[model samples]
Target chain A: MSFKKVVVFPAKLENLAAIDALIKSTAELAGLDARSIYAIRVATEEACSNIIRHAYQGIEDGTIECGCYSNMDSFTLVFRDSGHVFDLTGVPSPDLDSCLEDRKAGGLGVYFIKQLMDEVSFEHIPGTGNVLTLVKYLTPDSEKSST
Target chain B: MEYIVEKLKHCDLLSISGRIDSQSAPELSEALDKIMESGQHKIVLDMSEIEFISSAGLRILINAQKKCKQQLVAGELVLAAVPERVHEALDMAGFLPLFTIEDELTHAVGNI
Candidate 1:
């Protein structure tokens, strides 16, 4: 029902798996389902990978923090990174109607994150770094569904 | 991550096992490049053993698809026996429609 644990790790991509496992364990403890768990993992991976690639610009020395919270109905993950200040406002909404051949290669990461989670918001602290808050409701349907 | 290649009469099957994320994407991309260089454009990726995939992994797949299309291959890169978790990832990323997915390896191999 509240913030249980917060983990900080190097911005290196090697740490992504550890972060994924942490989120899975926390989501399981909060009684989320496989689909919900997988969604959270995808969303988290996109955000973290963005930090690893763009936020830190592939610098190995940067660090990222993942803070997880949950209640009976939902789970929230706050990803904070001290790599680069990312302005989420700059990202345009993806045009789903665009042809595959015409579509740009990048930009799908944030689109997928938006689709998987129930709520997503971005903040850039001028002095600190970028923070992305992602929330997914543990709906009754998700609880009842399997696989 | 482990990549095992099996040569077929008309195509080359690349079986990718383990997590293909930011850490392992480069390896997978390089493997795909090698396969393409060999002139075997028809590919059926046996993804049954892969436990997870990230956006980086998807980028590799997209690149491979583009390469195959550019080569004018008779068939595009296909995926066989994808696990539910991986399928969910593809679906969430809106990639399910982009791929020619099969539920069984036999079906994928036979179809192509």
Candidate 2:
């Protein structure tokens, strides 16, 4: 079986809770275990935060559309924003090996999205704006409920 | 997220419960800033009741840890009773080595 859910929210930090709730409920419906649900929540939150902070530059008037899709084998999240053209693929991975002195705070959001999701892609359409898709495969152990 | 600051004998204990995301991270940052400003760098962040944490929260943690350790006084931010899910998030971000993690809140405060 396949399931699809969509939600739209203003591109503001305050809407993150709503976004997180949507992701969590959708992941539970997709039969994801607690760990996998947490992974999806973190990845989706990171993606949305990137859109709000960088793409929109803290413009609360802007909007973000989130779509959740799930099948027997995988769950996916798609984010749409009509803000600046920010590409997650171009982000350099944070140097995790660096010591405390050299470590930086930024870039971890994109890094988390890339690390937690099994597949991630970002594209900018000429008129449609930025689209980020994150996919997490459902393993046998991670699928606790039936969808 | 909600945070309660307790001034311990050896360090400051910040008991945080609820989600720590981009929206709530700044508040947490401010709370930590206030603690650090008061010259209390040895902090025990009690994460037993925390529901979730994103990169935003992790950023605050790393920044706070750096500030605590880099000061001439050489203080520290210790994490205590971190839920398993948050622990995994920290591990994935390669942040496990950034601070000292304790399984018990009492241990965290006791050693700090």
Candidate 3:
């Protein structure tokens, strides 16, 4: 079996649902269960929202391209955006032990994306832009797991 | 996202339904703000219908929680009926321990 799909759309918060729906449909067709489908959708939303709000700084209207593919072992999602390159080093994971007054929700998006997917990677090109890839391994040793 | 505000005996209950993303997050903020302004310190967010929540939404929840905490003697915001997906999302974001969450609406309202 072979499966691959791609889409390009404007980078706007209004388009988030559409992006999620597109990926959710592809994930469903790939035979993911409800939990996996929801994880993909949420992770995709966090990534795209970051682009729209931070990468683009909610200022410049940009474009984002997304792609999805299903291999025998895992499901993969890709995001390509021409917005400003993200600086991962500058962001800190929120201190979960911090007092309520000290705790911040700033970096939760990246954190959630990392938690939901098995593997996540990012790259920045001088002339192009940032490319983010997220993958979720299908249940090991089996394409479907009832658990 | 869509919300319906009900006047429970002890608090202002807002049952929010739909995706609370960047676009719709402010609406929830506004609703909470208006409630706070009206001198209603206790708020119950019935999230049984919220299917998706992004970081943006979580930010609003944290801010609201902090603000309501100041009035803890008289006002607070609690969560009830959180769906499994939403629970997992919050847990993943390290937010499960941040708020007073209950399994049922009556329990949440009673706590506040």
Candidate 4:
């Protein structure tokens, strides 16, 4: 199947549902199984949520663009934002061994994106914007099971 | 996200549905705040109808549970009927062990 779709919208938390819905349909139509589709949708949602929270700082009026592309073997989702560039590399995954009383809870957004996707790349363009691409490899077991 | 709040046997039961992200996290927090302010500590979040969750949602749960623990009396937050998809997110976030989760609402309420 040949699938290349691009969606550009305001970078806001309210638009998260729309973004997630799009990712769900796109991944499902690409012949992915339920687990694969959920993973991709979650990663995409986390990326967009990061953009809306950190990049726009919940400003209510920034811009976010996403492209859903797929080939025979894998599916790729790219997110671009233009408010403030966020460096995901510097972000540390929350320590899981900490005590419940001492545990912190808000820093797991980016970590979810990294853990769920097979390949994740973040780039900061000199004069353009930030682009985060999350890839999901298609499996033969899921190819026969499409939801 | 939509929440259905009901005062059950031993705790305040909140049945949540729809997507819980940055936008809806505040709503959940607000609901919990109201319950907490009313001197109710024990709570159960039923995610049977919940389809999605993010860090924002998880933060609310953590905060709520933490505040409950700080109480001088009985205070607890449990989760019930969590879907597999929601479980995946919680597992990836390293939050599966943070709270008492049950396969059935009765068990969660009893456990709490």
> Which numbered prediction scores highest in TM-score against the true structure?
2
DockQ of each: 0.60, 0.90, 0.75, 0.69
Q: Where is model 4 more than 4 Å wrong at Cα? A: A58-60, A140-147
Q: Model 3: clashing residue pairs? A: B41-B75
**Order by DockQ, highest first:** 2, 3, 4, 1
Please list the residue runs of candidate 1 whose C-alpha ends up more than 4 Å from where it truly belongs after superposition: A1-3, A141-147, B72-75
RMSD of candidate 1 to the truth, in angstroms, is 2.5
TM-score of each prediction: 0.90, 0.94, 0.92, 0.93
- TM-score, chain B, each candidate: 0.94, 0.98, 0.93, 0.94
CAPRI tier of model 1: medium
Which residue pairs show collisions in model 2? none
Candidate 4, pairs of clashing residues: none
- Residue-wise C-alpha lDDT for candidate 4, range A27-123, written one tens digit per residue: 8888877888877877777788788878887466788898999888888998888878897756888887677798897678777777777788889
**CA lDDT for candidate 4:** 0.83
lDDT for each residue of candidate 1 in B43-87, tens digit (9 for 90 to 100): 999999998887789888877887887775455799999998888
Docking class of 4: medium
The lowest-lDDT stretch of 10 consecutive residues in candidate 4 chain B is B88-97
Relative to the true structure, how large is the alpha-carbon lDDT of every model? 0.82, 0.89, 0.84, 0.83
Candidate 4 residue-wise lDDT, B1-112, digit = tens: 8998899878999889988888888999999999999899999999999888877888898889899989999698888999998887777777778888899998888778
Tens-digit lDDT string for candidate 3 (B15-70): 99999988789999999998888888789999999988888888898888888888
Q: What is the interface RMSD of candidate 4, in Å?
A: 1.3
